[model samples]
Target: MSILLYFTIVPLGTAFLVTLLRKKKGISDLLAVLSSLYLFGLSLATAGLTKSHGVMIYKVGGWFPTIGITLVVDGLSAFLLVAINLVAFLVLIYAISYMERYTDKWKFHALFMFMLAGLNGVIISGDLFNLYVFLEIASISAYALVAFGVKPQNLEAAFKYTIMGAVASIFILLGIALLYSYTSTLNMADVAYCLSDKAKNPLLVFIWVLFLAGFGLKAALVPFHAWLPDAHSSAPSPVSAMLSGVVIKTIGIYALMRIFFNVLGVSINLLSVLMASGILSMVVGAFLAIAQNDIKRMLAYSSISQVGYIIFALGVGTPLAILGGLFHLFNHAVFKSLLFLDAGAIEYSTGERNMDKLGGLNNKLPVTGYTSLMAAMSISGIPPLAGFWSKLIIIVAAVEAGYIGYAIVAVLISIVTLVYYLKFQSFVFFGKLDAVYNKIQEVPLAMKTALVILAVICVMGGLMLTGTFRPFLEGASNVILSGTGYKQAVLGAIR
Candidate 1:
């Protein structure tokens, strides 16, 4: 549908327009907020269309899929588009107030919208080269945003991030090139169709390794996660929310899912590797988070651990496992963003991020504190909340898949997760009111509005598994479960 074009066009157009309006105060904010809101609504509409129409393919310039750019939306892409745009809209709202602490808010808006365009493009892109291009656009924007503060530390973090990101891009590009070389086509469906006829070979195995290394680094899976803590902690909080919440998922986990499960197809060896990586990330991230005093840094590490849950669940490759993985992906986007925004609110109020230096903020920033608590509880997998249900699904799926040992590890890591979050809650919100912060106030209204909306999602997110909402997650999981049928679906749609 033509509407698919708006996903990238609106954000790209807004980025350019906002840059042109540098002289108009508040105009950039107005445009950015309105564009994001529009995109969020558009994404929801697209999700509805995906539900009604199944897979929809839009060939650019009305050309055939083999020679033209194609933007496709199936249940999976529609689900991710909704998650990505919803989070982007909320993050933009929070940024309006929080970004006032920095100069040239217009520039921030421009880069943010630019990043959003890349993210949306990556989701809808139906070819490999365009996927890499959009991935780099988002990566470059993130690199600049990380250094927006212009601090020595911020620049250092951005530099490290850029280097690591470049390395990842190279690996991904090489994988794409190899795949194209083998298949003589860059269209995802065509590539899969070609691969289906070829016998499994060592070259395909090498390509899979290249992709796993590349996307694994992007996802911040353990051992490839060196850049994440610095990048997330150094960037603005709303940016951190985007990075931890959806950016990593769209460019990293989502790409892995599409390519591994849908394109190249999964293997026993691939599943084993994914499970190992996910377990390592879970253990390492939780341990590292426990040692952090910086709130953002701790939350950054927490993102790695939570991402592990999704990756591990997906690795199990059961229907229930895929459902849990996708659900947790959505839940993480909500609660993790909420947590980071709360951290931003704390910083806005007291200019402190060290938990040791912040205490009893609940009295001063009640919305932030309680919301943080709710997010904390939910992310810790407490009962009846979003995080709990997803985690429970994962654990049950693991047991059913006969990975009892891995299931036990997941439970232990969850307890570790609870410990660190409680530590966070106790250190930042539950202690006696500090004398230094007595006069500090809550964050501005826009920031508070974002936090509350996310908190409500965390509270209600469990309903996604029931009644009307069940189809959203189920639809996405069905896409992954379809295997090579995805190629047939896309090719058939084109004909």
Candidate 2:
């Protein structure tokens, strides 16, 4: 079988096998960690293969397009695979020690692997229905994970998230059904081929609106962002990291990009709407974050703001803008996950999540404090860090695209980002020691190890924009710039 298939299979197989071995002490952790490592290695290998071979297509049962399931690995898919699997591996390692407090650790690992399988599947799916299937898999896993603690707040948050998620899924399915009715094909390439010559009819517009609402909710853009702060804050820290770091990007932003750019093809009207939505998400999310005292809740709000940067950049529709968008996506995955993990560490040590109650922790929990500082600086776009470069690229691209007003909003919102994050730093790490937390120590070795690695990435992620790693971003950008020619590219690859 093709290596690309293993991205989905490995985690799925491990999830089930781990379930069967749940009664064995340490076996579930061993298998789960090993599975994540294998998938991370496979993702790197896929990146190399994609670089060498261009786009690749894996057919199931040797069936042709329109008759069977297919998985496509392009530069974009490879880029996301590397980011997703790398973070998953690190989060799994962190979970090993962090989850010791919870019972049924095996079930957590199983669900986590299941979520990873779903994420990989979504990234590679070549058909609309298949994408939905994987999306649901990931969504279901996430809902379960959100409520895994069974706390009152967790249960309430999970119920709210599930209701909203179900509505979004219905919208997406309705959109898919309408598109299939028009084109009579489930294959994404085939659907694009059929729609290529058609005019922008009301049916097409309706389908586009359905998709925008569905994927926009999944991406947590403002107005559709009601569930995010609650859901992300309520879930376990590692699960929160996965949700914000990769889940929203995978099933939400990635799906939006693939369908709008590659399938329906970008339109001026749609791009305008996207830009408007992004701007609102940026400004509104930042403001909400500023009022939050709960550490995880604030980070959850920050995720909405950061995602806005990506969506706004994409809406600009310039090659430079797209590059900036993709880069920010990667950087956000790194630093945001770092922040969430740090939040977890803080809670793990002191049992306090409210910023007002977490004063002067730096003296007691040096590792979490320092790593949190690095992550906060990066997310605030401090120079020489990964976040600065991507945010700069995006703003520059906006100005170049003649969207100066939007650029101004972005710049101002960036200041808001800095303000809230600094508040977070000051309250959590720099103030006088709260007597209650004076004796709290650093987190476990494994959690500390994950935080350090993610912080290192935050410091070094800018290298992707430099000499050797530049092509990885450029290659992914080129795929999107290919637009509806994606149909031709996929067809050629399969042939």
Best by lDDT: 1
Candidate 2: regions farther than 4 A off: none
lDDT of 2 at 97: 95
In candidate 2, which residue pairs get closer than 3 Å at backbone N, Cα or C atoms, i.e. clash? none
Indicate the worst ten consecutive residues by lDDT in candidate 1. 357-366
Q: Tell me the tens digit of each residue's lDDT in model 2 across 87-122.
A: 999999999899998999999999999999999999
Error of 2 at 110 (Å): 0.7
lDDT on C-alpha atoms for all candidate structures: 0.94, 0.94
Give the alpha carbon lDDT tens digit for every residue of 15-58 in model 1.
Answer: 99999998999999999999999999999999999999999999
TM-score of every model? Answer: 0.99, 0.99
